[model samples]
Target: MNTQSDIKLTDQLERDLIERELGTQRLGFVNDAKRVIAAVQNVFTRLQAEARKAKVVYANG
Candidate 1:
């Protein structure tokens, strides 16, 4: 019952599905990287604030 065109269509569909899944995985990785970058920025910001406070205390004392 299967023709050549039908086989080609099935192959194309399979390729599309694989590409879509890979795209989804890439998006997930990007989101995770963004979250990690944000966390590191927060840590650096807190450290800078603490250093400023320490400097002020040292200068005043």
Candidate 2:
């Protein structure tokens, strides 16, 4: 006994979910952004390690 509005709502949701799963829009950028973020984090970790190895600590006295 669903109304036309209800059917439309359901259809819209299905389409939205399919597009989201396929990453047809901004979701498509998520993987690329994650890769960039990970690369930056890796570089920061390496820099921190090098700084620690060299005992480079800033003391603002």
Candidate 3:
């Protein structure tokens, strides 16, 4: 039995947690773009390594 107030509180709590995790400084769009790009690159590199280990080949033909 969730009320509107409860829903609002839950949303606020989730937002707070995200802000805390990312930090206020990193929350700005300009400040986080570089971090986001680096994170994506890191993930891509890891996935590429996994593909190599699994012998999943890709050709740019």
Candidate 4:
């Protein structure tokens, strides 16, 4: 009879190790998302500036 009914050492150790691995993967994903957001913002800012300049040219001509 296994007396440790829901508290096996192997199970608990495996869960703890897997949880740490997942946490590290999640941190990498967050860093990647931030880098993508910054790149998109830069593109939009440049487009806006060009549009403004074209608008001024049209108004003058």
Per lDDT, the best of the predicted structures is: 1
| Candidate 1: clashing residue pairs, number | 0
- Quote the positional error of residue 59 for candidate 3 in Å: 16
Q: Residues 1-61, candidate 1: write the lDDT tens digits.
A: 5798899999999999999999999999999999999999999999999999999999998
Q: What lDDT is reached at residue 16 by model 4? A: 94
Model 3 TM = 0.42
Q: How would you encode candidate 4's per-residue C-alpha lDDT over 38-57 as one tens digit per residue?
A: 99999999999999999999
Model 2 / residue 19 / CA error / Å: 3.6
- Which residues of candidate 2, in runs, are more than 4 Å off? 1-22, 56-61
Looking at candidate 2, the ten consecutive residues that score lowest on lDDT are: 52-61
In model 1, which regions exceed 4 Å deviation?
none
Query: What are the clashing pairs of model 4?
Result: none
Candidate with better lDDT, 2 vs 4: 4
Q: For model 2, how does the per-residue alpha-carbon lDDT over 1-61 read when each residue is reduced to its tens digit?
A: 5798899999999999998878765666887899999999999999999888677444432
Off by over 4 Å in 4: 1-13
Estimate, for each residue in 1-61, the C-alpha lDDT of model 3 and write its tens digit.
Answer: 5798899999999999988877866667656898899999999999999988677444432
Error of 1 at 56 (Å): 0.7
Q: Measured by TM-score, how close is model 1 to the native structure?
A: 0.91
How accurate locally is residue 14 in candidate 3, as Cα lDDT from 0 to 100?
Answer: 100
